[model samples]
Target: MNRVLAFDLAPKKDYIEYINRGREERIGTMKVSDDYVRQCEKAKEIQGLWNPDVGDWIYSYGSRSIEKVFGEVTMRYTKVWLPVQEDLQAILRYETPLVMLQAFNDWLYTDSGYGCVNGARFHSMQELWLAFVMWERFSKVWDGKDWKVV
Candidate 1:
């Protein structure tokens, strides 16, 4: 299988467990944005991703795809995907300060942090779960067209 993200630091079992939490529990109480719904639609469109016809394949393919973009996959029993320490570092390193600030406000300070231990790094499970959430968000803007540049 193709490795998902460049920073594949999390374990595979973690991704499976997180995704197995099912959709509703993973999204929590946050208002599901139009963007979020759009993302789910994108995933459903992928050929082998989330095949509803096959009971065993619900989240596996989507999990693989998520790993490709986000490095790992994870899920939390919450409304939004909270950024982990690695994600915080990554956003700061690769994104603008304003974007980082927005991520913090949206993730760190919300109920997403309710059961999380506040520390320099989050529990590995937490980090993986966030990756899955990000994957869903990333799917929203993804067009099925080839990604390669001519």
Candidate 2:
């Protein structure tokens, strides 16, 4: 089976800001802002609309679980995307092929570990473009067609 996973390397401050924005958009019987609505629509396009409560629970409890899974899989796969700088470094210390995906305009994770990977860099495109390029390269090797698996 093909499995894909992602994490956020965002600093605590930036993560707090995003969570605060989500809270404000959802609080006190107020309608969400058009910008926030657009943002949510975009996220829904990618992750789909899980129930809000379930989504929040996943955000709260799923990160560590996902990390453990990623750690286990890193032993088997060459291409991996890591969110935290520490985890990325750990993976690289073992000489794994890792790609660090950063938001072009993000304040957090912008300068965290720019030179850690052998062929790593920031992705400065819309989310859809980022996903497209990632998969385009990944499929070639993962499907055992164009490139050799490591």
Q: How much is the lDDT of residue 71 in candidate 1?
A: 38
What are the candidates' C-alpha RMSDs?
A: 14.9, 16.2
Note the clash tally of each candidate: 11, 0
| True-vs-predicted CA distance for residue 67, candidate 2, Å | 33
36-146: candidate 1 lDDT, tens digit per residue: 333333433232222122112122344322212123223321112323334324533435768755664555444432222342332244332333334333322222322
Model 2, TM vs. native: 0.19
- What TM-score would every model get versus the actual structure? 0.21, 0.19
lDDT of 1: 0.32
Candidate maximizing lDDT: 1
Model 1's TM-score against the true structure: 0.21
Candidate 1, backbone clash total: 11
Alpha carbon lDDT at 125, candidate 1? 47
- The residue-by-residue lDDT of candidate 2 on 10-38, one tens digit each, is 43322211122223232212223323223
Runs in model 2 with CA error above 4 Å?
1-26, 29-31, 45-49, 52-150
